[model samples]
Target: MHVQKHFGKQGILLVNLGTPDEPTPRAVNRYLGEFLTDPRVIDNLPGPAQQLLVRGIIAPIRSGIVNPFKPGGSTKLYQELWTENGSPLKYYGEILTEAVAKEMGDDFIVRLAMRYQNPSIADALKELMDAEVSSITIFPLFPQYASATTGSVHQEVMRLLSKEQIIPNVNMVNSYYEHPDLIRVFADNARDLGPMDQWDHIIFSYHGLPQRQLKKGDRSGCHCYADGTNACCSSISRVNQFCYSAQCHATTRAIVAELGLSEGSYTTSFQSRLGFDDWAKPYTIDVLEDLAKNKGAKKLLCFSPAFVADCLETTIEIGLEYQEEFEEWGGEHIQLVPSLNGDPRWIAAVVEMLREEVGSNVVL
Candidate 1:
């Protein structure tokens, strides 16, 4: 390791879950091939099984190269999510990075990297390293903590830095599920939708992870997969602090508190579960169905707190497909609260968090 004693300028790396370079099937295929292959993403599966699933099933179906098992057209969804600029995820990420770079001026070098795909963590780190930044802080854009997302970014950062002869003072943010300003931005987005009473029910849906992943991550073996009991899995304790399910619950609680929503008015669920394996309980689809059918809910508001920017999961999945699902269940509307993509408050929160982690003197 290159051990440099005196510090130069602080380097800030803004990392987000990646997007395909283009919205085509080929692009989507390469993206999934890289993303799903990461051990952090498919942690529980055996290496051979993981490769088999990715190469034989997921990638081929996504790219439309294999026809026997035709999965839904990901390219169409990507087309819907694509804007004048490009993928919403990457577009907003670039805008956010530019905003932060301008805010910090030249003293701090702010670079954006996708955990997978173009502008990857490795290339971005190499850029920072070339700049000879004496210290570095990694800010994974995920609000809630999960090994698959934030943990993966940190793992890649360390793995690359480990090969270097000289290493700078490195720091990484684990999670900011309940950061005050972040909560404010999300809540404010809800508030912008007029009165809370307008909607019959509200749902905070976070990206899902397999329950097995939760169990694997649980250092306190007893704390995870407690049959969805609020006592054990709801509260963030010393034992289950890093649990993705628990933090999702915590984020819901915080945003609801900010909105002054009553206990029964809103609930939390997990989304984007794949395969037959059980994932974080109370799936978003189930919650939406129940709301539309049994609960007599007409209009519903959905918030995806896990994503900082509106992406495929947020825009096409929840906003479009979930809306269709809700309508099929006789629901009037299901409005998705927009993500905190380029919101100034969200940017301010990022700066604040960086300042807190680095020091008070960070030029923001």
Candidate 2:
């Protein structure tokens, strides 16, 4: 048996969607290699088959290493997103973790980890385990629950804990889609962009997942309507609770209500689809195109509620790339509301979540 040392009574592990350590092609390749290889992420085939596809096809195409078609494609994206504080995603996560740790005080030791990169989940758990924590609470940064993101984090946590004979009492925050505090933060961010009426249209663009993933998550089979309307995915109830698309819609509704936005003032779409075996309908690009071409909307405001912190997807994909596309389509301006990355409100929300989970007896 391993030596047991009393380090802390409780440990908090904050998990975020990973980012590359640096903006180099090698770093991007390494990060993507690990992230895309996960079964929960790809999910199209069996383990060996997935690995073959990832190592052979996806990784090469993304990193632009093997083939001559697009060298440093991902690397270029990373370059544009690089900040003085390093990757904005990781930097914000570190700040948020520190803020939460301070809020939690001495009782709970907080650690930050990326699901796919440096300060990995495996290493973070080991640190907590070494501390001999009686209980461990895992709070994934994903506000909305998805198998590929939150589910993958849970799976990895369990996989690591399985090796330890003395497993700590584990608790995971599955999703906080309608958390009032979270909704307030998002609404507040939108308000910071000045007036809602000043913008022609608001787009709540969330990360896309294959339709198959949605089907797999559908326990009721009746949930996840193909039309992408409020009738099915609007409410947060037991039947369609685990549905990511439904949860995304729920988040949009909550924020819009918080911001006093009326129906038809905003629209929801999915972004970042890969391979495209029919992802969540009405892609963000398509939505932007329609708004500019048919609707004659000039200025657009976008919100990516799927991410709590700004990453390449937010900073580059929506902020830079989407702006360029919209401009090409005769749109004058495209603004992305900043993510709740270490914002005072967001920090308070996280602290509140931890307190609620840990209980008053824990002495936080």
Candidate 3:
């Protein structure tokens, strides 16, 4: 008797942070509750305390559910961020996923998932398993490595796969902070805006992580915040290889090198900090203020390398909110370089990265 051999396609799971289902207070509230309560996000807090803070207080307040008279802070931002096609993050993820799938052809199956909310990791994983892929590659859409983002996504994927009776070969791309293709795409986007010299100053604003969390990731303990300075994060060493701030700096350096930006012509700062705890320093807001007020900066260009796609952070926060504040400080314009949202080059870069991952894996 002859037996049939089973051949399976490779699986690609691309995950982004997430967005609310709707631009409503309740939806935002639910989304925030799930996001903030993750231990990796609010790692400093214990489980019960974190739950209370997120579900009982923080989420309600941000969603504006506690006070019906006022529009929710995040909800209002989401409302402004929503487009005719819906949330840009999710929309771009969908487009990118479809593009990657088509590019990969019949050899691979690609799925897009959000770490939180709709099109969840669980469902994505289920689909991949159902497809009977021989292997699955998990790619979190964060340029830099952070416990709260990439680490969290990996943990969730493993947790879901742990329940399965048969688990396929798994690969996770932790951080591609200095990938040449990624840096080129960003530089190309800025070039499309005209010339690098046109802007008074360039700002590379990355999402902020609490200083305490940064230190927690440092096994050396003495590496991060040792001398009450960010000197340790200036360069990436084995001691700080996974350091988020160091990775962010590295990303900026790559882009700066590509654009031939002068040493003082560009600044690296952190943004979207929460709870007023000491976060990675030289906050973007402070940097903007100094440029406009003291340095007499007229035109500014900002790049949010932390985010691959435009969402509330890039569109509303940097594009609108920061622009407004800069103008208040007498600045002329704050140009936000577009993110890698379905750009043909960006799609090609992603496909290249995924192909590299798939090529490296042993076929079953």
The candidate that wins on TM-score is: 3
Candidate 2 segments exceeding 4 Å error:
1-7, 67-71, 226-231, 360-364
* Residue-by-residue lDDT tens digits, candidate 2, 125-224: 9889888888899999998899999999999999999999888778888999889999998889889879899999999999998988987887876666
What C-alpha lDDT do the candidate models reach, one value each?
A: 0.86, 0.87, 0.93
Global local distance difference test of model 2:
0.87
Off by over 4 Å in 1: 1-6, 66-72, 227-230, 360-364
**What ranking emerges by TM-score with the best candidate at the front?**
3, 1, 2
lDDT of 3 by residue, 227-322 (tens): 998888788999999999999999999999999999899999999988868999989999999999999999999999999998988999999999
Listed in order, each prediction's TM-score against the native is: 0.94, 0.93, 0.96
The order by descending lDDT is 3, 2, 1
Segments of candidate 3 deviating more than 4 angstroms: 1-6, 67-70
Q: Is candidate 1 or candidate 3 better by lDDT?
A: 3
- Name the best candidate (by lDDT): 3
Residue 87, model 3: lDDT of: 93
